[model samples]
Target: MNVPLRDPNIVMKLSRLGSFHQSKLSFLRSFLKEFKDWDYKRDLFELNEHGYGIAVYSFKKKNRVYSLICFANELDENERSDRVIATKWDAAFTLFDGVPAKQDIERLKNEVPKQEFGRLSFKELTLSRANKSVRIFNHVVESLSKGVQPDRELLDKVGYLYRTTAVYGSGKFGLADRFRIKDRKEIYGPFRLEMMLVYLVRQFTFDQVNHVAKNKNPKKAVKLDPEICRNLGIGNSTGLGMAPFIVNHPTLLNNWISARETSLKKIREIKNISNEEIELFLGCLKKSIKNITSWNTESEYQIKKIKSLLSDLNKFIMYLDKEFNFKQDFAFNEMYLDLEKNYCEECIEYVVSMMMEPFDDIVTPLIQEMSSEEGKYFNIPTERTVAELKAILENKYSEILNIDFSKKENNLNFWFISKNKEEPRLANRFDENGADLEQPLAIARDVKKLYDLLSVSKNSWTIAKFLSTNNELRHVVRRAFIVEKFPYSEIQDNTIGQEIMPIDMLRLKLSFFGALKFDPRSDKWLRICMFQGAPLPEQLKNYDEHWVYN
Candidate 1:
């Protein structure tokens, strides 16, 4: 059965997009699914008893081997922090394109841990760092040294032994530009290397914990239980840094959300379902309750959401178990219809994620489509007329045009890069004084301004001619054209509005990264965990597909 995809305009709402959950289509999950059959190994492990030294892990298939070279350092308690402002971390990691020689390891050892200040060569595919989750790290070490596993309940609350502050890839800090490896079949999905880095980092955390425990009491220390090790995943501390990524990559954003919406529409169009498929869907939906129940967060906003989500989920499950029938045609569609009629946004989305759990054939094919050739759409379609451009904006940005940018609150914020680290940040336009150097993220206001200016221009003028004179508006003009073709490419709301939850923007991107337990420290930044219940590298070849639920 054929079904129409939702327009990008409606689907790209900050709220709708922000509500996204990790499904079979999420990049990390897809990465694991794609590379599961590849070779996995610890190519190098040269750490000292204290676990302060170098190590390298690799996954090779045929001629290609992506090596993760890890450098562990002894940092004083005061030196370790998860904040991006901090310079030192307990460990630093990079995914090298192939096997590194002695000279390559020596060169990288000097740079990877220093992070931003250190220069990386093109040989590097991705760079990242993780500070120890000191409380858990020390507790696990102490427990295991005494030959005991740490408490599962307490470990589940925080979920990781180390949370990386940032994972840099695609040309930032001299890492190889995406163009260098964009064509590789294995990594065609977005953020595959970053996923590989985080996944390997998860293994590193397990190794470090075991190594420290083994060292402390050679006679008594037993290895960490593989089951417990499987439950612990890498953590991430993200901030406004990730928010702009969605804004900047228009086509990529479109592809990610489109894959999701397409999957939903196809599921909705299904006319029949087998008993086993129905059973699998029901099983996953029931099992995923652990994800919601164990989801820990301190944000009152998120806590309230979790509470409401739990209440609604319970009701939906009750309806499914008691009143619903799988004999009905288009069973999932009917379930979805009932959900939308009865549940909250959180519940509807949660059910939507659970629906994909049973249809690996449908969702698996869509996973490969989540990545986009963003640069292919980067150039302006200069051959179009000013009249055509105006019509495009009028149709695509009808809601955005209603925003009165003259109000102080509507024009409240400006996005900029901090000079020290060159990281993205937002500030008050009137109070902070960097608005003049504002980044091109203020698309809603600028698109309106571009439209106002274009309304008076000759209808026959082409975009090439318009861009030649209106260079400042070039970015948004290019984006407007993108929004025309890729409906879900632009945020419908004014990002600079005083009421903007910048964390919402950050949450949207992090959700795509398969991050969970979003702990918003403030409106601007938050901590999250990645690969929290994912398979370790060694277990990748024969792993449970529903590890996230487990």
Candidate 2:
């Protein structure tokens, strides 16, 4: 309680946020912990010899049942693409509200594979489609059919057999909106249902691959080793489609970062360290080395980060073993200070995650706090005076206010939505044509403008009076008030600057989703693996909470 939370200005920086690692508060890990006791079943798996058919999996507890209806289809090697325009997918999946009947399956069979072109009824909660990582998928199939396990090194290299291009929910494509199911007890956490769908899809991957292998050599084939399956995960290729989300949802972003900061703050406040807790933290830290060392990426940007993380982690390990004393008071606080002083942002944040591994009592309660009722903070305080609004801008957005937006490079980029996909994209403002239609994702720049306008406004005038004339800055006005209450609400950087890395934005969100092995394909898009080394469906009931490091 004595140690202060990290400054929001420092924590909400794109560079620091981009360095975030998965922790206990991550939705996927929390999803597993929350629903582990539910009964899991292969409710309907009707795959053909080539593995093209409908399969359904469910997790049921009492009367509540959520089903994943999967439609695996044959795709030509040339047709398989992770692009949004690719109409055909190797498989399409939807998380159903309850068990899907034969008639319901038939209904979805016609529409699910059609993806964005199709309509999903209110019963479906989330929709996603993935293409095979053909080389890895076939390698697994061939190895299994030939009566052997796939090469461990190869499996380790690729990490997954399928890579999802998109996952949609919240009224998109006519699926059930958040308001419809937000009150569910099990889904109190944000993206819980999406996490559920993805987790179940992971199981489907193992099942489908094994089915195809068995069909290929009915007599000799063996199922994939559960050990190997445990190591594998679902891959995803994310683009700028996700970059705007962090900007668009300020309260939600605050909740996510606030949860992480609160956890770290609480952990650092620990006055005494138990020997057991120390060992658990160190054990997770030591085992997590493989996660860093095995991270594969061709992006020189990420390669440098990985190497720096590994080096700092090793240095930290040596310090812990040879010099640091757990018997000291507020040991975690002391260690955190050391990391901040001596390590890269990646290493500092990675250890921040490991620090929580030993403190379920600290992290568990915070999981429920990550989701936001964003609407609660939507209204601007129109009654407040211009003086108060300007004070907020000055106090909370100090870093943002300092950005020189008049510089051409600082104003070089714009965010816009593509017509066909309705996805957010980043473009060069000078060279690209859509600067005129740019979305208001330029939070820092706009906030700066709001500050400038406030500077000349009468201090005695209420915001209601100010807005009546300067209404164009209303969105940033709303956000400034939101940021006043939710400290981590806005990013403290120039989003449209020439040096901006949209991947940093995507990486921040993906880390919260518990994604691993982030491979930046470009500054605008990247690949990631989810549920890597997570427990399988059947093992859920008794899975280790720290499976990430195991």
Candidate 3:
């Protein structure tokens, strides 16, 4: 039996997209799987009593080596800030293309810590900065120095000792452009290097905390238990800076969503499932409950969603344990339909991700297809007639066209780039003064305007002729053509709407990164944990693939 892929119109809405969860295809999980056989080492460790110095770590396989050069600095309590404009952080790091010599380390010492202000050569593949969770960091150090493990409760509350403010790659701040290393087989999946940087950073936090503890009391201090270290992953604080990425990378976004939809379709098409697959799926679903129960968040918005998700998951579990039978044909398809009919968007998407856990064959191949050669789709098909473009817009952007842009609520917000930090920001169009300089991120509004203009234009006129006069709509015209082929390419909602939850955009991207425990601080920013409960570098060689649930 063949199952149809989920409709893009329903899946592409911000709320549904925001409801996405990490699956086997998430970049970090794939990154770990790919590098499991590679050599892991602490090539250099030269920190002082205060853990203020340089450290180097590497993952090498055969001739290729990717070294992470870390520089830890002492910062006063007042100096640490997670804002993008902040100049100082507890630590800074860069993933060097290869092993660094003394001179190379010295060169990076003066540059990596400076972050955006400092220039990076092509040798640097990814750069990032992180601030310590001072309260948690200090508590762990104090407990370890006193010959006791830190309070696991406290550790679980805040999952990491350090939280990176930003992780930069793809030629940002003069870093190496993607073309320089895009062909690397190991990194063919998106953000593999960025994952490497964060994973290695997780180790650095462990090493730094241990070193500081040992220094505080040489004889009694004990090493942190490896189990504790594994549970504590790196934290990341993300802001609206990630919101515009989906709009700017239409083809890439489509590839990601398409891969997910395809995976679901293939999984649901399976007519028979073995007992082992059923056991694995059931086990993951049950173990994953801890993740939901322990998900701590103060944001009422997130809390309500979590509550609904947990309640629905419990209901599904009761049905699975009591009424559901694995002997049924196309069982997953039936399960999916039941989920959609009974659960909220969050629960349905959550179970969809969980369903992929038992089918690596389906999810593994889709991972490579997530990255896009976006340039191939950039040029508009101007040779086509104006009527063709209008039809494409009308069909591809049906819900978008229905929005009444003239309503103040529909056109309430504007997105603009901050001149100082060069980051994307959202503002009220009515209350703020920057609507004139708004970025071209309001795709729904602009597409509607384009449709109104095209309604009266000559149907036979070629797009080239139409664009010659209506050049302002050329961007959306290119997008319309692209979306004609990539159904999930365009979001079906108004981005500038007054009720828009900007965190939804960030959550969509973060989910692909394999981040968990999304703790939204506001509508515009959130905190997430990565690589938590993942195997350590030393254990990667023969680790359990199902460790996510473990």
Model number with the top lDDT: 3
Per-residue lDDT over 1-550 for candidate 3, one digit per residue giving the tens place of the 0 to 100 score = 8788888889999999999998898899999999999999999999999999999999999999999999999899899888889999999999999999999999999999999999999999999999999999999999999999999999999999999998999999989999999988899999999999999999999999999999999999998999999999999888889988999899999989988999999999999989999999999999999999999999999999999999999999999999998889999999999998999999999999999998998999889888988988888777899889888987889888999999999999999999887789998988979888999999999999999989989999999899889999999888898999999988888999987999989999999999978999999999999999999999999999888888
Give candidate 3's whole-model lDDT: 0.93
Candidates ranked by lDDT: 3, 2, 1
lDDT (tens digit, per residue) of candidate 1 on 80-155: 7777778999999999999999999999999998899999999999999988889999999999999888988889
Model 3 misses residue 498 by how many Å?
A: 2.3
Pairs of residues clashing in candidate 2 = none
Candidate 2: RMSD over Cα atoms? 1.3
Q: On a 0 to 100 scale, what is the lDDT of residue 267 in model 2?
A: 92
Tens digit of per-residue lDDT, candidate 2, span 293-319: 889889999999999999999999999
Give the Cα lDDT of each candidate. 0.86, 0.91, 0.93
Q: Model 2: which ten-residue window has the lowest total lDDT?
A: 420-429
Cand. 2 Cα-lDDT: 0.91
Q: Counting only residues 3 or more apart in sequence or on different chains, how many pairs clash (N, Cα, C under 3 Å) in candidate 2?
A: 0
- Kindly give the stretch of ten consecutive residues in candidate 3 with the minimal lDDT sum: 373-382
- Candidate 2 residue-wise lDDT at 207: 95
